[model samples]
Target: MPCCKTCTTALYITAPARCSPNGMKYLLPVRLLLLTSCLYRRLTSASTMAAMWPKVILFRDSITQYSFKDGGWGAVLADKLQRRCDVLNRGISGYNTKFGSIILPKIITKETASNVAMVTIFFGANDASLPEINPQQHVPVIKYKHYLQSMIDYLKAIEINEERIILIGPPPVDEKAWEVECIKKGSTLNRKLAVTGEYSKACCEVADTNNINCIDLWTSMQKVQNWSEFLADGLHLSKKGAAFLEETLTPIVLKKLEYVGLQFPYWADIDRDDPAKTIEAYNPYCPSQ
Candidate 1:
């Protein structure tokens, strides 16, 4: 329903200790005074001006909120962001970019508050599903790009700056498992239309050309040995898988928001330049891995 308690506990346990005021152990009185002064300055800086805080809205589909066992990434991200800003989930199951483009305007109208800092567009998974099998069509790579670009244009048309939009590529589909599952479900057409990396690359190109942030969930998920463990089916993430995705994504999202002069709480502790300190999971679905 929210962030995984175990995951949060693990994050804190693995986090590097906060820098102390004293060179030895705890902060001395003099060090504490200096630290407080620094903190005050940081809090009052031009960049940290509270008025510019941005509201974040996530525009995704079924895969992002498949069920209680999956789609928890959005919830997890919302949990971390709720402390710093207004976070809303606008995920609609069985919708694609085409439908999203149609409904997003209505959502924008409802969440009429200005100063929208970020909108994470996580679609294309269902769009990649074939017609006659899934209600959504099998959008070819070229058409898919057009659909994505159209969505971007729609946002810009509605006054959402292109830089504030994020295009999240769909997570990798297990081709073998997908085919098997589709066949079992009597959906032969879908078995032939599962998405591939080339489709994802097209989406990335559109995002890059438009100067929007692109989160490559496809390639990122490929590195994990236990990819199936995260998926409810071949198409959706498992609860554990969603938590892992959230853990991997929050920092990147926060950094992007920060670059645009939006303020949000820092959830990840790893230094940007320090790769070794970064958390890399071999198998987040299983602790032993």
Candidate 2:
């Protein structure tokens, strides 16, 4: 029993940073200290770049919430950043700048916000709702601007500065299609493409004033001859629209991910015949550039 515990302790200290999906099935219960240590190390890394991987946060509304769905932009980003950075989705449905600004601090903290490569702020759809027609989500364009800036300030307080932020303006809406959707949900048409455009431009203004990155979805979509095809339910993005957004962001995201480092060595990079030697050779580095 003494020899067994000694062997287990040795394995625990020398455990590889990365583990298989089956978990420590190869390890007996007595040797589970390896698992606990691995988890604790991962948790600690969340606050600093000392972990196996860095993270990028997607902060947005419904558009971001549905980002991981099939053919969604989030999935595209994840694929592009495989083994480079972990993408943390912090999306909420039906939220605008007012509510988003209030919940900013709750979503992230200084401890968990460290080592974040970039954060994408995507909002304004609900805020663009017509005042008299859709009062529930209506936010004055001017107030919306302030709320966005406030959110940016909150991020900065968490150590995520403007240099690492990307503001995604509300995408162009299809008024005719969206009106039908509103009626089906027991409400009149409460949003307009033109008005939504104004909000998008306003978002750009904030990004410009702060000297951060901005993706003007509104104007960019309009440039496409059939901008309406980009929208699903007149508000969200269709698959093609998601693809467009993904393509637009791929290069930009890659550029920012240059700061992130790989969490662990790739399987192919490891020498299975000499596991101990492979672990010793591990180096923390990012291949994004």
Candidate 3:
């Protein structure tokens, strides 16, 4: 009779006749059915999101390779993106976009199997090193602009969608270091190389006009008081520096891929102002710090 009272209270919300001892057994089955339905919906939504995320490919130079004691930014980026989507690093040491244009297709063919969802192109440090192309040189700026335009055009022609391409401007070089090194080495032209700021701005302009995403790392690096934090040498990135870059750019990369209906894995928020604050100082190749 006590059991009947509790059952009657539960059944009052529904049908009292159904609260019979024999009928009470159906409650467990009903609860199980509801739980199964909820889980099924959750699984379906997760699968759909996973199918929507895009695969990314990165192209860069020595700064991305860590050939120097400080490793490249691309390596950090690859590690960050390792879980969410496929990140392929195709960076080579000492190569410019001219070489990039020649070899990118081959690399894509071999590495990506010709199926790239997005590509990030970073170059021009070496190209801007031309003797006659520096800001002070008499050479026309149009030539440099033309080279960039051609690279963009070639990417479009090779079946890479414009929407899927991002152009990252080079980071600032240490002008004083370059000047001192050039002087020590008696290389006048090195001192006369294109100003890092000017070259980066020019590249951004081209990317803007061509409807491609551009991140001006030159401007970003300028805000850091210690330039050495971003580049161990005047030209390449240190591990801490590369981590800063990856943190700043990863959000943008995820947004772009999302726009293309691609799902990306989790993104870690990195402080652009102090990426190296928590990281232990360690050489990329050497075990000794």
Q: Write the per-residue lDDT of candidate 2 for residues 5-91, one digit (tens) a residue.
A: 223443555465236757556544424443332233333332343453557789888999999999999988998898777888889
The order by descending lDDT is 2, 1, 3
Candidates 1 and 3 compared: the better one by lDDT is 1
Candidate 3, position 105, lDDT:
67
lDDT of 3: 0.58
Q: Is candidate 1 or candidate 2 better by TM-score?
A: 2
TM-score of 3: 0.60
Report lDDT (CA) for all predictions: 0.62, 0.77, 0.58
* Candidate 3 clash pair list: 52-262, 52-263, 53-262, 53-263, 54-262, 66-71, 66-72, 84-265
Report the lDDT tens digits of candidate 1 across residue range 160-199. Answer: 6575688888877766667777788776637232355766
Q: Could you estimate the TM-score for every candidate?
A: 0.64, 0.78, 0.60
What's the candidate order when arranged by decreasing TM-score?
Answer: 2, 1, 3
Tens digits of per-residue lDDT for model 3, 1-289: 2122222333343443356688768665543333231122223333343432335777767665552233455655555555445777667877766666677767664323323557888876765675543444222345556766776776665546566688888777776666666667656435222465677888899988998888888888777788656766666676766777777777877665442221322124324565443122211111122
Instruction: Mark the regions of model 1 whose C-alpha exceeds 4 Å error after superposition.
Output: 1-54, 67-71, 110-113, 131-135, 179-184, 189-194, 259-289
